[model samples]
Structures are given as structure tokens and as C-alpha cells.
Target: MGKATGFLEYERQGGVLVQEKQRIKNYNEFHEYLSEEEQQIQASRCMNCGVPFCQFGMEIMGMASGCPLHNLIPEWNDLIYKGNWELAYNRLKKTNSFPEFTSRVCPALCEAACTCGLNGDSVSVRENEHAIIEKAYKEGFAKVNIPNIKTGKKIAIIGSGPAGLAAADQLNQRGHSVTVFERDDRPGGLLMYGIPNMKLEKDIIYRKIDIMKEEGVEFKLSQNIGKDKKASEILKEFDSVILACGAKNPRDIKAAGRDAKGIYFAVDFLTSSTKALLKVRQKDKKTDNLAKADGFIDSKGKKVIVIGGGDTGNDCVATCIRHGAKSVTQLEMMPKAPEKRAQDNPWPQWPKVCKTDYGQEEAKAVFGSDPRVYQTTVKEFIKNEKGELKAVKCVNLEFSKDEKTGKNLMKEVAGSEKILDCDLLLIAAGFLGSEEYVAKAFGVELDEKTNVSTQKGRYATNVKKVFTAGDMHRGQSLVVWAILEGRECARQVDEYLMGYTNLSPQ
Candidate 1:
């Protein structure tokens, strides 16, 4: 720790953001970085507990309690507090390949499990991390680390998302030749498309990819293994293949008129929006087929209905507001959570409660009302004469314990059907699993939930030289988990390829 009495001297100071009214007018990041002095003070707040549960990465009640990548939180926080930013950045890079992405989007499990949080506020670990890495980049401290010797082993990483990228980073550091294949036009998979540009700027991803390229990692874009190129062919050329394809199979709504026009998956909408933004940025005059599809589903002058209440749903609301939507509403099947932690939830656990995210704040600023509706679900779609969705029929629900199963079950309230006028509908109902095409082609077994089946510790599949990581192996999760799985999976692949490995998790 920087100062013995730092926690007592300084209270927690979170990162500041632009006002909602000003931020909603454009699709750009509005979060302001804390000054260097302020960041140092925040770093000083780390009490550096004896056990340091913030870096333990244990599973409490099936949910991750700390940094899954096992970041050296105390060491880095102490480093930052002492004005040793370069050392802190190096410590962060030891485990995570992409701190910029996680710093921006991750939910910050470390703060939730902080020992200081038991009595007072937790340290601003995430913000301190963001400051350290960003400063390293600006001061030319972050550079490509090229291995001195080559192992003569070749590895193919399928999907260029966080998991694949982390695996490639580790394996390449071990002197293994690594090539990543992505079906999309660019690398970074979901980071490039699924997430909105406002949350994570595409240039940040490209900058990291450029450094990785300089480090001798090859990225093949628009190459679909098992489709454009055969999976068997890749297996023959490379000594080992790792499938890092993320969970892309969206969980769809199957109500009446589900196939009607104007209704789309949240991923599809977000992807289109990002593509449009990219095209505009590059000044591409040639219109693509998607660009020709009534011009990218702009919410301008339209009433929007989002069919979920998770982060993705909230993102949809924010995007719609930016596009100048007339109105916006988000539906949640589960009842609203309590405003504060419940009695069952104790110290050192992730608190489950209701909180307004950035998107809801934007919606409230523009429309003068909160956009979420709790304990509600869409039952059917009302279509116009042209077979386009015009509105959604929905109903309220009540939750009660079932006598037989002793589980909470939802019961729709009788005579509670209602219709809301809507011109655009976005289904943000989450993902099922990784896409089936590559898994099926490789003959990989899948769990009941459609995730690739593999033992937790042993990430290898039934196939001898095949491995899996990220959402492909563990299903939808945080970027931090993806990075951890990727790093561990790369160590496994290294040992399998050479019969020994020196890649360190420390």
C-alpha cells in the first residue's frame, strides 16, 4: 500500500462522465479520465488486505468474486500509488492481453470483492488500471514482446475475440507460431461488431491488433474455417487448433408474427450500426446490401420496443436514443430487484440489486422517464398491412414458489394483456451458445446448453489436437473470464504441443 492510513485519509472517488443530455447527442465515449494526482490518491485507497480477496478469483455461489485473470491487484495498486505507472502496466500485462477493453467494459469484480468494501467504499481499482495502461501506451512503454527463440510449433486459433486473442498472445510469447482466423471482415470478433462503437471505440481494438501483428501473430479476416476453408485442412497444416469462437447463436423470441419485418436480433442491429459507422468513417460510397436495407434501422422518428432488460437491452435503448427515437421502452420478465442487497447476501459477495446503467440515464434524460418495465414480456407482434411489425402485445407476470419443485415460477396475470405502438423491435434475450457450424464440422461434443463440452481444468476436446476457450467452452461471460480462460488454455496447448511448457501465470 502507498500510505498506511490512505484508506482513512481518502474516500473512494469514481471516474467522472459527461452529462447525460450532452452525451446522448452523439455516438462517442463520454467518460472523462481522472487526473494523474486523483488516480494516485484512488490507488492509495487499496488497504492491501492480508489475504487480498480481490485477486483470489474464487467462485462464491457459482459467481466469480474477484479478478478472474488473477491480476496482481495489490502490487499494481501499490505501484500506481508510488508513481510507478510503467511497472503497474507491466504487471497488468502479465495476465491480461487487453486491459484497455476490460477496463472500459468489464463489471470490475475486484471492487465488488474488495476487503475495504466490508466497512466502507472499495478502491477505484478499475480506474487506476485504466490510467496505468493508457499512460503506458502514451509514454511508449507498451511495446511488442518478441520471443527470442522459435519452438517450430504452429497453432491455429479460430475466432478473433478476446479468448482467441489472449491465447494467441500467450502462445506467441512462448515462441509458437500462431494464426487467428475470423469470419468477419475485421478481427476482434464480438468486440469489433457485437458491442457498440460508443462503448468501445474500434480504433483501440485495431491499435492492439497492430501491436500483435508486429509481434508475429497473423490474423486472417473473412476466412471461415469449415466453410471457406476446411477444418481438416487447418488441422493438417497446424500442430494444434484452438476454437475460441464466441457464443453467437442468439436466443430468439418465438411469439406470434415473430418472422415479421422490422423485428431483429440485438446482435444484428448492433452489428449493422457499427458497420454503418465504419462505412461513414471510411467514406465508403459504395452501398452494401445491409446498407441498402432501409438504411440500417435508424430509430429516428420511430417508437422503439426492446424485448429484454439486460446490458444488451440497455445498450439498445441508448443507441436508439442517439438515433433520435420518438420513444423507448425495455421489457424485463423478472421482477425488479431490491434497491439494496438482500439479507441473504453478506460481505465479499456480489450484491444483487437494481441500479440504473448509462443507457437508462440517457433514455431518462431524453424522454423524461425511465425506460424499463419489470415483470413484463412480449406475447405477440401486431403487424401492419405490409407484414411489418407495428406494435407488441404484452402481459404482466407474478412470481411465486412452486410446491412440487420448490422453485420460483412466473405466472402471467389474467386479463393483463396490453399493446404498445412500436415501429422497431429489438430482441436482446442473450445468447444460447457458440455457433454450431465449426463445432459440428470438427465433431466436437456440445453440452445440453449447446456450449462446447470439455473438462474445466482440461480445456481439450475429444479430438486429440483440438482445444477450446472463452464463450465457446464456458458460454456467455465477462471479458475478464474470457482472457483468463484464453491464457490457461494457451498454457495447456503449449504443454500438449511440446510435451513441456514454461508459460507462467504469475
Candidate 2:
């Protein structure tokens, strides 16, 4: 759809990244976008291949190969390459509801599966998407679109994360009155608090939320559906209830002296950090001066140890560095991945290679080395006389394959215990599943994995007019997957309410 030989003629160039040395000084979006002309050149590199796997949206070897939302990559790339910004945004929005969020935070599965990436650099699809969405907002193409017809049906979405927001957007557009309930003060659940502000600025979330409010979608923030408002009341009021609260019940570290005062869950830490920043910004209209905010977990001049080596751990490392930490260390139970893709992990399959995310990059730039310590786990949390964290006892781990099961098993290595000074410990061990209270409150059954259960390949619950989607239904996953499930769930709900739906069949 782009230039026939553009892939051969042009090289891949991405958005300008602010130097870590300077960007780490504050919490802000650090990537500077390219000009429209430059983005058009990048878009022109789209091969328009016979099999455009960039939008395949399927599983390969149990790993996601492309955009789960099935974005029309080629058509939008062609439109952008022709300098048709409005049409590019139109095509882009046909599939994705929140391009701004995904363009910034998504791992870019599209590029991973691009045909050009098989031989060389892939098209900068994510950057192109970012450019298109930002331009749409600038040119007023993304203004509020209030529904003209009212179907008189009401929907209650019991969360404000990507999934809940997607469903609310879709259902509201379909002429159903939608009210989104969020326990947090802000509307974007994980996106608003769980994710660090530097990765996704709060203003960006607010921008879209304001548009939704103008478009007739109601947001009841600081309202916990089960506690603040009863489930029975919501059921009686709304025609359909969608539980998209997400899997946020954190898996805690079960180590000796686990009750240390300075240890906290990763989500709590991130939420507090973002809240502190926002409080400071709101008071002074500035991003800095966070020291004045209350309830902030101060890591200044403290030795910090983070448990788990995923994105949350990396975010903790960067947040600690920004807090003026004395030193930082990250513990991971699993062994480090290979620097490059393994033979078993080929192209079009999600690569199992190591990635240095933005947070890790900032940590290295400040600390002179990567903070991750693979094949290691904390054995005990050493506490002081006041029951505050003072140090951590760690042990090395080793893995061996079992001949019968053909599965790898982990064991603690003998005589490898070490004690490191740690004033603060953050557990980023991930989530178990959706919190049981919400499910129990609504009489929703849970699967073995603790996710809200449903019939195979369906969003309907045992209760009539009650559906579920996103992490609550499928366990923890990416934002793109959440949006896809939300859209699908909305279609199901529309059909149930009106006995038919015109929404996309995604």
C-alpha cells in the first residue's frame, strides 16, 4: 500500500528519545515525536506484503505474534505515507479505541511480526500510530462524538481500566447509557496509577476521559462497586453489568520476617509515587517538588531491594533512582533470558530474548550498571529493633530438567546465601488474579486460576445480564488484549439487550 521500493530505499528511524541523564531528573514522557514529514517517510517503508502478519492477531507457539486488536496496519501506513493524516487516523481508529495509550506502552507486536523484520528493520508502526493519534487530537479530529439515538438501555462497567473504558466507549457509542465505576479517584485504573507517570503521563489519560464524559459516558470515581455501591443496586439499575475490574490481587513474598515495616507491594508503591507527583503538580502547577507530598514512600538515601524482575521491578528501580536512593538491587527467581532469540523461538513468534526497558535504562544510566540479579530470590527480610527493614537474606537458584516430565525444575543452590543491606524492599512478584471480594460480592464464580469464570469462549456469567471481560476473565494480560476482550464483550451485551448488534465482530 506504500511505495513499492520504499522498504529497500529507506532506513528505519524512530522517535527521538530524551537522554536518560536528563530525563531521569523528573517523571515525564521522554520520547519526542518526529515531524509529520519524517513520520510519513517511516510509514512509506510498509511492504504491503501478500500476507501482512503485522495484524494477524493470532497465537504462534503459545506466544502472541501480532496486534491483538487486529489493527489495519497496511491501510493506515498507506494513508499516512500519502500525508492523509485524517484518513490515517480514521483507519487506525477502526480497530483501536485508544491508540495514544497503546502507541506509548505496547510492546509493538506488530513490528515483531512484520515481514520486513524477518530480513531487516521493520516499519515504525507504533511511532506512526502515535503520530497519527497526536495529530488527530491537535487537528480536532478526535473531538467528542455524542450518540444521537438513545436505546434507553443502561450499562454498568465495574472498573475503569483499559477493558472497562473500552466497553464503556463502545456501548455508549451504540446508544446505551454507560456509567463506569472506579474505586480510585482517577478514572484510568491501572493506567492511571499502576503504571508510572513517565511511561504514560496522567494528562494523556485525562484528555481522553474528558472526551468520554463529553460524549455522555458517566464516570463515578472513588466508588467501589461492591462496597461503596452494592452489586444488587447496580444490577437493578443497569440493563447489563460488565465486570472488568482486572486481576490486581498481588502475590506477596512468603519469606521469613515478611512483616517488615518498609516492605510494600509494587502496585502500592507505584500508586503512591504517582499520587504524590500528581498532588505536588496540582498544588504548585509543577512536576518537581514531590518531597512535600504526604504518604510518599521515601527511598531517598536508602538502600532498596526489589523482588521480581519484570516491568514493575524495573519501574521500582527507576523510581528509586529518581528518589535519590543510596543503591538499588533487583532479585529475580528465574534465570536470565538469552541475549538473542533462541532457535526454538523463531520470527513471528514472541521473542524470548532479554529487553532493557526504559526504567532499566534509566537505572543503568544513573547507577552505572543494570540493577537486575537473575537466578536469585530473597530468603528472609532482616528487620531492625523497630520492626523496620534493615537487610535481606538472599539465596541463589539453579534449574534442572526432569527426564520424565521434560520440564525444568528450580532448586536452591547450597551455601550461596548472602545478606545485603536494604532499608526498603518492594515486591513486584505479579498478581494471583482478580480479588475474590468483588466476585463474591456479585455471586460471580471464579476459575481455578481465580479469574472470573465463564463458559468456554464466552463473556457471559452464570447470572443473567451479567458479563465479564479483560483480566477478570482471561487472567492478567496486555492492554491491547484487554481492549479486544472489552469490545467483544460489549458486542455480546448489545446483542443480549437488543437481540442484535452492529458493532465490529472482533
Q: Which one is best on TM-score?
A: 2
lDDT of 1 at 411: 90
Compared with the true structure, model 1 gives a TM-score of 0.97
How do the residues 289-371 of candidate 1 rate in per-residue lDDT, one tens digit apiece? 23334467677778999988988998899888877789999999999989977888876778787979999998888889999
Candidate 2 lDDT, tens digit per residue, 1-506?
88989999999999889999898789988999889999999999998889999999999978899899999999999999999999989988889999989998888999999999888998999999999999999999998999999999999999999999999999999999999999999889989998888889999999999999999999998998788889999999989999999999999989899998999999999999999999999988755667889879988899999998988888898888888898999888999999988998989898788988887887888888888899999999999999999999999999999999989999999999999999899999988999988898889899898999999878999889999999999998898999999999999999999999999876
Per-residue error (Å), model 2, residue 53: 1.1
* Clash pairs for candidate 1: none
Candidate 1 C-alpha error for residue 28, in Å? 1.5
Cα lDDT for residue 477, candidate 1:
84
Off by over 4 Å in 2: none
RMSD of 2: 0.9
Q: State every prediction's TM-score relative to the real structure.
A: 0.97, 0.99
The local distance difference test score of each candidate is: 0.89, 0.92
